[model samples]
Target: MPTSSRPAAFATAALTAGLALWTSGAPSVVYPVYGREWSLPPALTTVVFGTYPVTLLVVLGLFGGISDRIGRRAAIVLGLALMAVGTLAFALAPSIGVLLVGRALTGAGVGFALSPATAALAEYARPGRGHLAGAVATASTAAGLTVALLLGGLFLDLLPDPLHLSYWPLLGAVLVVLVLALRLPSGARSSGSAVRLLRVDPSMRGVVAQGALGVAAAYGTGGVVLALGADVAVGLLGTDSPIVIGLVLALSAVTIGVTALLARRVRAGAAAPAGALVMVAGLAALVTASAAGSLPVFLVSIVLTGVGYSLLFSAGVGIAAELAPAQHRASTVSAVYFAGYAVQAVAAIGLGQLATAHGLLPAIVAGAVVLSVLALVAGAAPFVRARRAVRTATGGNPA
Candidate 1:
C-alpha cells in the first residue's frame, strides 16, 4: 500500500490477468485443426472455445473478493497453478470434453487471478498514477492476447508436436511470471475479516454501465475476429497462408497498445468519447474491408478498432477505481470483465451459428452494430454532462 509501488503492481496484475486471458488464446493456432481433430461442428467448436470464459465468469462472480481476506500473492500463485494444470490436461486431452475441462480450469484460474491482481495493483501504485493504471492493465492483456495467437500459429505451423508444443511452452513462461509475482510486495492490504460480496457504490453505477458496453466492444470484436477472420481471409479473400491471419489479429493488439499510449496523455473523460468515435470509424472500416475484400482496409479497420477498444477499456477501469470503495475495487473491476466475457461467450456461440448459416459476415456485422450503437451512445452521454458542468461553473447558460 505504499505510494511508489502502484505502477509495478499494475503491471504485475496485468501480467497475471494476461496469464489467464492468454489461456483463452490457447486455441488460436489450431482452431480448424482442433475442431476437425476433435470432430466438432463450427458451432460446437466455438462452444469449446467459449468454455473458458463461461467458467471464468462463474468463478469470478462467485469468488471475486476472496483475496481481500487472504492475499494477492496467494490468489495469483493459486491461479497460475490452476492454469498450468489446465495446460497439462490440454496436453493429454483425447476428447473435446476433456478440452472443455481444461478450458474450464483455465477460466477458473483467470477468475481467481483477475480481481485480486487488479486490486493489488491499486494498493501498490505509485503517486498520481490513478488515471493510467487501467490502460496499462488492459494494454498488457491485449498484448498478451496478440502474443498468444502468434505463438499458437508458430507452434502449429512449424512444430511437429502440435498438441504438446503450443501450450507447454506457455506453461513454462507462466511459471516464470509466477516467480516474479512472488517477489511483488503486496502485504495484506485487505481488511482482516471474512470475505463477502462487496456492494456496488452509486458512483460506480455509470462506469459499470459504460464498462459493460466498452468491454463488449473490445472483446466481442476479438471473439468475432478470432473465430472467423482467418477463414474469411482464406475462403472469402482468397488467401491460403496462416501469416495473414496472425498479422491481421496481431495488428489489433499493437493498435490497442498504441491507443493506450495516446490515452495516457489525456484525461479519461476526453479519451472515452474519442474511443467511441474511433470504434465507430473502425467498425465502418471493418465492414468496408470485408465487403470489398480489401486487405489494406481490413488492417486499417482493425487498427482503428483496437485504439477505440483500448481507450474505452482504460476509461472504464479509471472510472471504476475512482468510484469503487477501496476494499471493493477488485470486485468492481472483475465485474466489468465479467460483462466482457459474457459478451464474448454469447458472440462466439451466436455468431458461430450465424457464420454457419449466413456466413461470417453477418456475425461480424452484428458485432459492429452492437459496439457502434452502445459505445457511441455512452460516449455522447458525457458531452451533455460536461456542458452542464461548464454552465454551472459560469453561473449562467452559455449563448
Candidate 2:
C-alpha cells in the first residue's frame, strides 16, 4: 500500500467499523413497533434483539481470525455484503421469523467485520500513535450508534412505512461502505489455524481476562440500554413518540463518542478501573430512575453509562492492541469482543424474560445488581494482581 493510500484506508476501515454497529442497532427503535403491530410479548421482542449476538458468538468463535489468513480487505468486503443482505431482509420483513433471520445475518456480518476493521485501524495508524486507533474505533462505533437511534426514531415518527424505511437507508450505507472496503489495501495473508490464532499466551492470560471483563461490563450495560431503554423512556416521559424516545436514548451514544475522544489520553490500566466505577454508578442511577420514573435521573443514567462504556471499550481495545502479536491481532480483538457479546446476549434475553414475568422495575433492579457486581470485579482485578506481585516480590511478607 502506498503511504498516500494509508489515510484513505484508515478512514474506510473506520467507516466499516461504524457500519457494523450501525447495522446491529438499526432495528432497535423499531422493536417496540414490532411488538405493537404483531401483538408480540416482551420476551419475544428481546429474543429478536438477542438473536444478533447469539449468531455473532458462533461466527466469532469460528472465523474471528479469518482476516489474518484471507486478508483484511477480503474479510471486510464479505462481511459488508452479508450486512447488505441482512439489511434488505429487515426492510422486506413482514413477519417476526424474517426479522429473526435478518438479525442473525446482521450479527454474523458484524462478527466477521468488526475485529478485522479494528485491527486494520492499528495497521494504518501513524507510527508512535497506534493508541489513537482504539479511541477512533470507539468514537466511530459511538457515532454509528447515535445515528441509528436518532435517525431510526426520526423515520419511525415521521415516515409512513416506519418498519421498513429505516432499514433501506441502512442497506444503502452498507453498500457504500462495501465499495470503500474494496478499495482498501489487500494486505499480505498468512497461513494459520484460526483456533490456534485465538489462543492467549499463559503470561498474557490475566491481562486478557481483565480486558475481556471490562468490555463485558460495557457491553452488558449497553445491552440493557438498547434492549429496554425505549420502554423505560416511554414509561418515564409519558410519551409514545418514537422520536422523543430515540432522542432520549441517544444521549448515551452521544456521550460515548464525546468521552472516547476526550479520554483518549487516559491509559488503559487506569481507564479500566475508573470506567468500572462509573458503570456501577450508572447502574445505580438506572435502578433509581426506574423506581421513581424520573426522566431527569434517567438522563443522568444514560450519560453515565455512555461515558463508562467508552472508557471500558477503548481500554479493552488498547489492551488488545498492546498485547496482540502482529500476526494474530484480529483474533485477539475478536476474543475480547466475543466475551462482551456473550454477556450482552445473556443480559438482553434474561432481562426480557424477567421483565415479562415480574415487571420492568424488578428486572431493572436485578440487572443493575448483576452489572454492578461485574463492574466492581473488573475494577478490582488489576489491584488484586498488583498486590499479589508485591507479595511475591517481598517473599510473601506484608508490605
Candidate 3:
C-alpha cells in the first residue's frame, strides 16, 4: 500500500474505533439519571452497564477473528451500522428493558469493530511507525469517552431530554462515519478458518499472554471506576451534580490521552510492567479515598489510574500488533481485548453487587486487592525475564 493513502484509512479506522467507544461512553454519564427516574438500585444500574460488555464478549468470542477471513471493510461497516441503530434505540428508549437492548446492540457493534479497527490502523500505519497505531488507538478511545462525557454532561445540564437529545448528534456522527468507512480500502483476505486465526503462534504465546493480562488488569480497574465511581462520589462528596461527575470521569480519559501521546517512544516491554505497578498503587489510593470519603485523594487516584491505564493499553496493544503475523494480527488483537473485556464485564457487575450487598468500602477494598495482586504479578514477569536473560549472558554473576 502507498504511504499517501494509508493515513486516510488509518484515520477512518481510528474514527471507527473511537465511535465504538463513544457509544460506550454515552451511557456512562447517564446511568444515574436512569436510577433517579426509574427508582432503581445501584445493582440495576450496573446491570444496564454490563449488558454492553456481556454482548461485546460474546461478539468477540464468535467474530473477533472473523474480520481476517471476511475482510476489514465488511466487518467495520457492519459494526458501524449496528452502532448507529443502537444509538437510535437509545434515543427512543423509555424503559430499562429497552435500554438494555440498546446497550447490547452497542456492545455488539463495539465488539465487532474493536479488534479489526485496531488491526486496520496497524496495517495502514506508515512503515516503521507501526507503534503509533497503538498509541493512536488508545488516544482515540480516550477522545471518544471524553467527548461523550463532556457533551453528555452539558446537554444534561441544559436540556429537558438530555438522553434523547445527546444521542441525536452521536447518531449523526455514526452515520457520517459509516459513509466515510465506505471509502476505506478492502482488507486482504487471509486463507484459513477464523478459528485457526484465533491461535497465537508458539513464539508469540508468552508475549501475547502477558499483554492480555496487562490489558485485563488495566481494563478491570477502568470497569470498576466507570460503573461505580459516580455513585461513590455522590455518597462521599454529597453532590448530585451530573456535570461534576462527568468532569471527573472525563478527567480520567483526558489523562489517558495525554499519557499515551507522551509515552509513544516507550517500548511495550518496559511500559507494561511499569504501568502494572503504578496501576496497583493508584488502585490502593482509590480504595483508600473511597474508604475515607476524601474527595482530594479520590481525584489523585483517578489521575494516576488513568495514566497507568494509558501505559498498559498502549503497550499491550502495541506488543500484540508488533508480534503477530499480518494474517493473524486482527485475531491476536481481538484475543487480547477478549481477555480484557471479559474481566471488565465481571468487574463491573461484581463490584456493583459487592457495593450493594457488603457496602461500597468493602467492594472498593476487595476490587483493589484483586487488581493490585494481578498487576504486581503481571508487571514483575517482564523484569524477572530480563534478569534471567542478564544472568544467562553473564554466566551467573554480573559483577
List per-candidate RMSD values in Å: 3.4, 2.5, 3.0
Which candidate comes out best when scored by TM-score? 2
Error of 1 at 110 (Å): 0.8
Judging by lDDT, tell me the better candidate of 1 and 2: 2
Q: How far is candidate 1 from the true structure (C-alpha RMSD, Å)?
A: 3.4
- For residues 1-399, could you state the per-residue lDDT of candidate 3 as single tens digits? 232267888999999988987898887777778898889887687688778888898888778887888888888988999898889999999888888889999999998888989998888888888877778889999999899988888888989998688899899999998888887788878776654325666766766777788788888989888877777777766876878878888888999999989998888878887788789878988988987889998988899889889888888888787768777787789888988888887887888788889888888888889988877766776676577668878998866
Question: Roughly what TM-score does model 1 have, to 2 decimal places?
Answer: 0.88
For model 1, how does the per-residue alpha-carbon lDDT over 197-283 read when each residue is reduced to its tens digit? 544556566666666566766677667666666666676547655656776688887788777776675666777788889888988
Name the best candidate (by lDDT). 2
Off by over 4 Å in 2: 1-4, 38-47, 193-198, 384-399
- In lDDT terms, how accurate is model 2? 0.85
lDDT of 3: 0.84
lDDT (Cα) of model 1: 0.72
C-alpha displacement of 2 in model 1, angstroms?
Answer: 16
Tens-digit lDDT string for candidate 2 (26-79): 887788789998899977986887788888998988898888888899889889
Alpha-carbon local distance difference test for all models: 0.72, 0.85, 0.84
